[model samples]
Target: MSDSSALTQKLQQQVLELPPESLPDLEKFIEFLRFKFQPRKPKATAKPALDATHAVRLGGLLQGYDFSPELLKEARREMWRKFYVEAE
Candidate 1:
């Protein structure tokens, strides 16, 4: 017969010859194989649509407002002064 068919026959005989106490472990192994080969469902990804859209629009809105690095740093310090003071 074919090599695969012979191997299958040997495997079946081995399974049949296994002790009763080992059957539970064999059943668990079969279940593990079944679960491993089963098709998986795709997971849904969560996204913040409003925030993403707002960020995209904000980038476009600020595209023409080019400022110096020193000015931007000053603006950031002024905007976060209260938080910085509280941190200290």
Candidate 2:
């Protein structure tokens, strides 16, 4: 096996055999090691917020409805009509 892996396994065995009094410090060190090496999840981009006067959050608004692909198009067009149509 790899030298680093062999060393890690040896250290783990030593830690396992240590007295209970030594465990709290080892547990705290493990937490720090986990925080250092754990991969972070990617952050999701927030959806653009609706400026009801500018554009609606069509995806957010339509999330309440069933998966009607055709209706989604119609709802978007209706949203544009409401937001963009001149009162005159």
Candidate 3:
């Protein structure tokens, strides 16, 4: 008999002795094996702590701008990027 045929026969005998309910999840295992692996996410850099002085400066800067709802949110986001965004 061919090597592959003999191997298949041995594998079939092994499977026949296994409990029907306890078989490994072959599909899920194959899917796991087939998955394209990705690298782990990098840890974010530490943020600078906010202080009373910075708050006062921000308040002073924002007090003069036109503070419409959308503009307010955009300004807040810009301020965060300006003051808190990590330098790569």
**Candidate number of the best lDDT:** 1
User: Model 1: which residue pairs collide?
Assistant: none
Query: How does candidate 1 fare on TM-score?
Result: 0.46
Model 1 lDDT, full chain set? 0.87
lDDT of every model, 2 decimals? 0.87, 0.86, 0.75
TM-score of 3: 0.30
Point out where model 1 deviates above 4 Å.
Answer: 44-88
Candidate 2: C-alpha RMSD to true structure equals 17.2
Best by TM-score: 1
Judged by TM-score relative to the true structure, which candidate is superior, 2 or 3?
2
Q: List clash counts for every candidate, in order.
A: 0, 0, 0
* TM-score preference between candidates 1 and 2, better one: 1
Per-candidate TM equals: 0.46, 0.38, 0.30
Better of 1 and 2 by lDDT: 1
Mark the regions of model 2 whose C-alpha exceeds 4 Å error after superposition. 44-88
**Tens digit of per-residue lDDT, candidate 3, span 1-88:** 9999999999889778878675766546656776746565666886667887567444576576687999989988998898776763
Q: After superposition on all CA atoms, what RMSD does each candidate show versus the true structure?
A: 9.0, 17.2, 17.1
